[model samples]
Target: MLLITGITGHTGGYFLKELINNKYEGAIRCIVRNTSNTSSIDNSRLNIEKVVGDLDDPEFINRIMVGVHTVMHIYNIHHSPMIVQAAIENKINRAILVHTTGIYSKFKYASEGYKIIEGKISELIKNPKCPTSITILRPTMIYGDLCDRNMSKFIKMVDKLRIMPVINGGRSLIQPVNARDLGVALFTVLMSQKETTGKVYDLSGEKPIKMIDVFKIITKELNLKTIYISVPLSIGVSLARILKILTLGKIDSIERVQRMGEDRSYSHNNATIDFGYNPMSFEKGIKIEVQEYLKKNRN
Candidate 1:
């Protein structure tokens, strides 16, 4: 049996669909906190099962890990493995952890002082009897139709305002991988030979695109004429700090601006060489994603 966490999100949904489409005959279990809407989910693969429970609950971990041979950890949270300590104790092997690139790229404390998040996952992987033959996948700027958080928000904001926001001329490089491709990569890692254990793969697009060029893609996709306005990082950070204070860290326009300042360019050579993983071109993904958005919003 294979267990998938965060089965409702973009990467998880794509992984589920791909696994089902591939006619994977193994028992597939998804861990979700909410069970109120299981009617619409595809059950073509009768081996699929839904294990309901909160990610933080140890009982949920216990329920899903029973007789499970492999686990794909995509549920993003602070200290997620702590919840699944029972699985480690049970000695269930072949765990693939899907972590964020933020822990690698956007982490301020990593270079300056100590390795906090990634370091902890590494420590867990080192445990001899932990039953976690871990493969850590850190992906950069995952963008797709169901992706409403980062790049999608920028597209939506631009579409709504008929203007694009640029931070200091938007020269920072970005490597935005499609969510579907990310899903495929995860599935690949999960299903690969046991030799892939203890490997760290940095998944990224074929090439990095400039932040300004990303705005151009959104403009062309939406067929909207918009001018880019440059805002300094200092100004953006100051405003975001104020908004965080005013909205109690809920309003996030300022944080987006801060993230736009990072250089997210990454090399895909290691990922390709290790697991034969190659992400689709950004140009190709943009068209498909735009169509999906149009289809969803039209109804």
Candidate 2:
């Protein structure tokens, strides 16, 4: 049996669909919270099952791990240790975790949290007491459809304002991977679990582009006239900090602004060498996402 966490999320949803379309022979189980809307994934497949519960609950973890062999954790990285503990207890052999490249960011808080989780996972994987093999994939900014919280927001902003702000001339480099491509990469890793165990790979787009260029590509795709205003990084960070305080952290803060100003590009060569992880170009990915966003909003 195969166990999947966060099956209803963007990347997870794509992973689930790919699995089903490939006619996976094993039974699939999904753990979801009570408030999670499964309407989109409420399929009639006999092999698919949904269990409602919080990941924080030990009882829930115990119940969900029964008869499950391989686990794909696509949700919160914070809950990974708990999941690994439960998987070890249940004698599950292999596990894959979806993490982010933000762990390597210059921002202290962002890097610290991911670093803690990554360290915990590494420690557990190395422990002889736990024999479950682990594979960790750290992907760069993921953007696709309306569900994405990253570039989709920028697309909407450009569509509305027709003018966007560029911090430090938006020179900071970013390699945004498509969610579907990420799903494929995860599947590839799962199929080659033995070779990928106890390894970490950085997944990214085909190439890195300047932040300002990303905005220009979006505007060009939409055939919209948008002007970019270059703002000093220091001033932008200060304004974001003030807004963050005023909005009670609802808006971008100092750390977020700092991360935006730092380069986030990474080479996916290791992933490719390990599992043939070839992702599409950002231009093509953004074009597909923009089309989806337009179609979704048109309804």
Candidate 3:
């Protein structure tokens, strides 16, 4: 049996599609929140079961972990420790956690949170009482289709404003991985469980591109004449802070502005060497996303 979480999310939704396309015959179970919409995933022909509950509940976690041989957790990192504990109790053979590459960011709060979660997973794995092999995959900024928050938001902003801000000349290098490619990477790692057990891999795009170029690609795809204005990092951060306060924390924060100025490129060599992880180029992925965004908005 295969157990999965975050099936309603972007990457998780794509992962479920990949499994259904490949005609996976295993008894698949998905844990989702009551408010999550499962319309995107086609569970018609598959032997699938849905467990609607909260991750914080121990009884709910234990109930879904029953008879699950492999657990693919793609939800929030905060609930990872609880899920890992439940998996261990259920004697699951393997657990694949989909974490973020933001853990490597210069931002203190983001990095520390991921580090703590990673630490908890490590501690559980080392426990002699628990023998479930764990594989952690840290993906770069994941963007694909209209469901994503990264490039899709950029497209929307450029479409409306026609003038987008570029901090520090937008030279910060970023490797934005497509959600479909991430789904493929997750499936590949699961199939190569024997070699990937107790491993951590960084899943990134085919190559790194400047943030300005990313915005350019989006503009080109949308056929929108958007002007990119370069701003000093310090100035942008300060303005973001003020806007955040004025908006009552509804707007972007200083930390996010700082992150925009920092390079977030990561190497996918380890994932490639282990499971043949080859993602599409940024331009191609962004084009697909732009089209999806336009189509949805047009409807």
Question: Each model's RMSD to truth, in Å?
Answer: 2.7, 1.6, 1.6
The window of 10 residues in a row where model 3 has the poorest summed lDDT is: 38-47
lDDT of 1: 0.74
What is the clash tally of candidate 3?
0
Instruction: Kindly list the per-residue Cα lDDT of model 1 for residues 1-299, writing each as its tens digit.
Output: 88877777777777777776777788878776665345424555448787777767676577668888877878774545653465576677777777766655564543322246556656666766676667778778888774646677766776778655588788899898888888888877877856478787878887999888888887788788988998888887888888888998788566466777888888878779878997888888877877777677766
Query: What residue pairs clash in candidate 1, if any at all?
Result: none
Please provide, for model 2 over 1-299, each residue's C-alpha lDDT reduced to its tens digit, 9 standing for 90 to 100.
Answer: 88999988999877877776776778889888889888756773537888988988888888899999999999888989888888888899988999889899877788889899888877777778786888888989998777898999899888888667889988999999999898888888988976798899999999999999999999988889988999999998899889988999887667778778899999999898888889988999999999997787766
Model 1: per-residue Cα lDDT at residue 244 = 85
lDDT of 1 at 283: 84
User: Lowest lDDT 10-mer window, candidate 2?
Assistant: 39-48
The TM-score ranking, best first, is: 3, 2, 1
What shift in Å separates residue 152 of candidate 3 from its native position after superposition?
A: 0.8
CA displacement after TM-score superposition, residue 45 of candidate 2 (Å): 2.9
- For each candidate, what TM-score against the reference? 0.89, 0.95, 0.95
User: After superposition, which runs of candidate 3 have C-alpha atoms over 4 Å from their true positions?
Assistant: 40-42
Q: How many residue pairs clash in each candidate?
A: 0, 0, 0
Using lDDT, rank the candidates from best to worst: 3, 2, 1
Mark the regions of model 1 whose C-alpha exceeds 4 Å error after superposition.
Answer: 39-42, 77-79, 106-115, 252-255, 296-299
Looking at model 2, the pairs that clash are none
Q: Each model's C-alpha lDDT? A: 0.74, 0.87, 0.87
